[model samples]
Target: MADPTTATPASGKPGHRRRRVRDLRAMPGFTTTAWITIVTLYLPILVLVAFSFNENRSVVLWTGFSLDWYAKALENDGIRNAAWVSVKVALFATVISTIVATMAALATTRTKKFAGQGLVFGIINQPLMIPEIVTAIATLSLFALVKKITGLSGIGYLMLAHAAFCIPFAYMPIRARLETMTLTLEQAAADLYAPPLKVFTLVTLPLLGPGIVAGAMLAFVVSLDDVIITLMIAGPGETTLPIYILGAIRRGITPEINAVSTILVAVSVLLVILLFVVQRRMQR
Candidate 1:
């Protein structure tokens, strides 16, 4: 044997080291940027949640423990009315958006070479990709023109504006579900002598139930939290919770706003949990 070790290539050791480095690079690890972003975004929310229970009026000092702010927020007629209006608007917008989005999802996913299908989907999803401020301003301008001609004055303007913004939020999840769902069950239902209505009622609707519920919840949350579009369209008496919160904060940030914010956050968390349960049941 003429020295077996001499047959190994000189580049082998460095090549191994380079491969190890490449593998390390390919596997993602938390970086400085991610940490910075987490701190920047969540720190304020942490502070708000923490100080909501503070006894002092000023947020800077936590004088003692108290639930007085929550009580006061509940008692404020202005806040109560604004919250009720927001709930109403959000519910209406959620219903309308969910219906339109579900139909759009069905049409886009089920059909082939339909005229205007592309146009319809594009228009329905445009709000999501476009700047929200642009949509708000355009909606306000159009509504202003309509009001001048028709003399219309009601919460209808706010409802329409919220629905417009909520459509894309509702469409995306339902479309995703439709695209991923297997059609074999529907086909089998047809083969079994089931009518189209029966198949849809017994098979398709139940399968799509989780998706519809999730999408509606998303739309409702978006509508509830919307401030820019609501502020642009809502009339004086039709002040939604977001607009009221903005007005309150402009005066000064108070524990009441914190209490309200906590409640909103709690609602969103509960809905998300409910969605998870529904989705799990559907999968089973």
Candidate 2:
């Protein structure tokens, strides 16, 4: 074992890196630590999924395996309504956030450096820096004021809140893609007398499409998983799936929640796979 109390001498040999790589398997407790970490992270999810198929009502006690809970989860009107609301909010938020973020990414990446560029970047990424509860409370206050002024309280407020919060999540991937992209194609189009709008739509946008899709997927997942902000801004009839899950959890744990959770996890995994596939194809 390497000395814990004393500083180890640094290796200056050319073959030192390969030797370290070969010795990684010999490190004390390496395999045990990795197995423990994996079990700690994934064991609960596997247990939940297993119990979700239990024929018995008790979530903790597993009986014979069955699919009744999934059927129940599907048939529950409250669950259906909440799931629909979540889907709607996620779709709208993803669309609006992706569009706005795409434009913002282009502006930040394409334009010459300006005096306020740093400030603009900071503002765009404020949500990532600040605690979400702070943003939620602030958004709630703003919504209340707006509602008072206009006497309106619809699901649009929920959509707007999600879109506002997800902007940074969507912006980052798009900006990264734009940064890595070469300007040769766009420059060639410009030299041939193509207008800026035409160049963006015909050339840049196609190349950026995968990144836009990835950003939209990320924003959608974030909005779907968000609880605090949705709870704060949600009206009586605008409950999303996360809000519904929170209420259900407060009441008690049930196999119904496990079924719903398993379904959501499956869908999320599928979307992630799709996002990766799209990005890989684009790279090819």
Candidate 3:
């Protein structure tokens, strides 16, 4: 009898070896780092949301938990006025930015080739790449020039500046969506003798709906939160929420500011949840 350990297949047969696959994704260090990063970044946001309900006026201390801050925030006239202004700016800026960005995206993506496309994209995105202070100064200077030349002043200039600032934020996602989307469906519609307006309304616009909505949301949020540019470009009685909050802080840290912050935080949270639910439903 042959020894068990020494047993072998027939001489002409080849030896078989199994290849073990390694999952790069399952690496322990990588997962640990990712979890750490997520926690580090989100912990402050979670704390902010949690403490917004704190009864204490102090941001650092949690004396007790109550909903009084929300009530006070609702009743505060200054906060309400600032919030209203911010809402108007965000709404107008979002609409104008969406329209402009959509046109820019369509122009860049649909045209086979266009002169100065790169230059145009660079100019549109300059605000994002440059420092806020630089943009604020430039906007202020331009506002001065416009006022000197036109001898006109109103909220319209503020709206235009906010829209311009928001254009890059709106353009990025819309342009990306356009690039990834196929043109065959649009071409097919045109071949079927569909009018240009009808083709855009029925085919292109429908497919681009989500991107447009997302871009609008982003532009609105940016406009709502902007401080420096708004401070520079805003006219009389055009104080936004962030600027109000800053002024409140400079004067003193009052329960009013805390109250206002809490309310804003709550609204932001609700918006996020609503967006998530809408996205999930759309996917389904």
Candidate 4:
């Protein structure tokens, strides 16, 4: 009548039962499959980073290690200008998206649930759910109409496009932070006759800082690396780093291009690390 799974071993002690544990590592080919997947995903990245340090002009050929390509990429005026443009656009987009996302998160999390709340969430996350190409095409069409009406052309278009798509990226973390927060402190402030505005600025905003920062970093990274949206929205003379890299690739791959890509990968990794740290702090 004893359970088979929890039955005691024949040679073991009478009072203790040995439970069966599912060992994924013991499965046939599990280790090999995992290793293959890891290597397949990361081998190209490893190759790219390695070749960035190669002294050879050819990306595939192995030569002596050198920093010459990195130097060349930095010294290139086109790359410098494109990098500057990317920074400006990313900064603008991050600020705009973060502010809007924070406000939206506050409104949704602080109030009573209303009808159409699910629809509102769906609308907010529409860009993330839809294909990037579709968003890019739709943004292009919208911006084209605005440009025609206003007779305007500038980097502002690209900034707005990036911000529009980045809103959901910024919103998710802020909303998650707000949801995990306890109502005790805010209720205490209310009981003490603190106005809602004062409670938010003095109590809520400080508590929400980590989420805001994480969201901003995420938005900044998304805006920085956006190729499809940037390509569709960029005006004449508004080339960004990704676009620059694309042009360079069309010409041919070189160590300089590899160096630039490696730098971008490094930057993205750094920002993601910082974001992880902030999220950990929020958990504490």
Candidate 5:
């Protein structure tokens, strides 16, 4: 007997019923909403990039396209100094954060479940969970105390503060990579009578290299663009590029400011692309 649920329509040749499945993409206004969201997010950035090439002093006024602003930004001593400072801080922060994050990832992932493991993870990621303003304020108080007690002050303070916050950013990628890796290879190396240190040097380190690089790149970008923490930790004559940009904006937005911002955006985008490429290769 033919079941009613399987009954065919009048035009159907067989009793097979075709269900009408609705696709999310076919939903009303889905495409329009997606386009609107993308435009809203990126249009301002497009405008900023466009004005970076403007020849006129006015940022909004349309003028002939020129590279004069970029050239001026390069020649400006303040900009150059600030850029140098940013690079130095970012490098130090990247190194410190990457090393600490790598070690923390290995410790947490390679061991058996134990007491306080979740607590350890929480401590490592505390900075990320807390607001940047809170971290800045706490860092300021600590540094102020150290300065009062030891009277020691320099770019080192900024480097340490940046590294402290960058650790969680660096930790995430390394931990994810470690979790995805299988233990088979490491176990085989152990079966060959290889020392733990030798096995790690030849096997584990090579496999983990891409994640380490990705984490370092991410940490570098975070430290480079840091404003609030740097502002709080930096001493006199220790301005970074972001701080310099803040000063410039306060004075007035200029073509030079736009040019510098565009350059910064370019660097950040390039690093992020490289990080993505490395991770994709690691997946294979």
Candidate 6:
């Protein structure tokens, strides 16, 4: 009888030691590179968070843990006003961006590709490719002309600017989701003679919910943390949190800034987790 353990193929001496699949993280350089990258990116944030509660006023010196900085940050009128402005801008931008992105995604993804399809998509994503400073400068000049001609001014303009800038960020995920969706369900619904509105409202919107939520949250975060555009367009009296933080840091980094930074980081982390959870549930 032939020995099963010694089985071989033509010209193949018993196979070399059966190779096992290796996890990418277990590879020679991957783990080291990952650790180095993580530390480089996040060590400053970790240090800032840790020192937010420092008893000492010196940001670099950690005396002991205390919540005085947090209390002070909450009581600071500048911080509060800036935070409120950020909230308003972020909320308004998120709503407007999500709506515009959804319609754009639907138009691009659901329709037949034709002339100018590439142009349309390129325009939609132009903000991402152009230098942010260039966009900021261009927006400032346009707003300046508009102000000169129309006498328009206020936080509303800032919201509109943020919405316009955030549209591309919101469009990508929604478009990706729409592209991956199977047309079978929508076609099936139409075959039953259901109206377009009902078919979309009942069949398409539900499946697109996760992407919508993710896009809205992403837009909100981007708007909230925006500095260059907001700095260019915001009035002397108006400042969002990011602008406020940047100005403060230029003068000096303080514990109050650290406390606010920690809170912003925590909020961002929570939103990211929520997005992950929604996506996971959709997958299941």
* Model 4: residue 204 alpha-carbon error in angstroms: 0.3
lDDT of each candidate versus the true structure: 0.87, 0.91, 0.81, 0.91, 0.92, 0.89
lDDT (10s digit) by residue, model 4, range 1-284? 44554454563643343322334227789889999999999999999999999988877789799999999999999999999999999999999999999999998998999999999999999999999999889989999999899998888889888899999999999999999998899999999999999999999999999999999999999988999989878987899999999999999888899999999999999999999999999999
- The candidate that wins on lDDT is 5
lDDT per residue, candidate 2, 1-284, as tens digits? 35322233464553665566567658788889999999999999999889989999997787799999999999999999999999999999999999999999999999889999999999999989989899999999999999999999799999998998899999988998999899999999999999999998999999898889889999999999989999998999898998998899999999999999898888888888998897787677
What would the per-residue lDDT of candidate 1 be over residues 144-233, giving only the tens digit for each residue? 999999998899989988887898989887887888789999999999999999998999888888889889989998999898888888
Q: What TM-score would each prediction reach against the true structure? A: 0.86, 0.89, 0.82, 0.92, 0.92, 0.89
The superposed Cα distance between candidate 3 and the true structure at residue 284, in angstroms, equals 9.1
The per-prediction CA RMSD against the true structure, in angstroms, equals 5.5, 5.2, 6.8, 3.3, 4.1, 4.2
- Write down the worst ten-residue block by lDDT for model 3: 13-22
**Candidate structures ordered by lDDT, highest first:** 5, 4, 2, 6, 1, 3
lDDT by residue (tens digit), candidate 5, 1-284: 44443454563634233232223227788889999999999999999999999888888788789999999999999999999999999999999999999999999999999899999999999998988998999999999999999999898999999999999999999999999999899999999999999899999999899989999999999999999988888998899999999999999888899999999999999999999899999899
lDDT of 1: 0.87
lDDT of 2 at 144: 95
Which digits, one per residue and each the tens of the lDDT, describe model 6 over residues 1-284?
A: 25443443442444431222223226788788989999999999999999998999997777898999999999999999999989999999999999999999999999999899999989999989998899998998998999899997887888898999899989988888888899999999999999999999999999998889989989988998899988888998688898999999999878999999999889888998998898787677
Which residue pairs in candidate 2 have backbone atoms (N, alpha carbon, C) closer than 3 angstroms, thus clashing?
none
142: Cα error in model 5, Å: 0.6
Candidate that would win on TM-score? 4
Off by over 4 Å in 5: 1-25
If ranked by TM-score, best first, what sequence of candidates would result?
4, 5, 6, 2, 1, 3
Least accurate stretch of 10 residues (summed lDDT) in model 2?
1-10
Superposed Cα deviation of residue 261, candidate 6 (Å): 0.8
Model 6 sits at a Cα RMSD from the real structure of 4.2
Evaluation by lDDT, superior candidate among 3 and 4:
4
Clashing pairs in 1: none
Range of the 10 consecutive residues with the lowest summed lDDT in candidate 4: 16-25
- Give the range of the ten consecutive residues with the poorest summed lDDT in model 1: 1-10
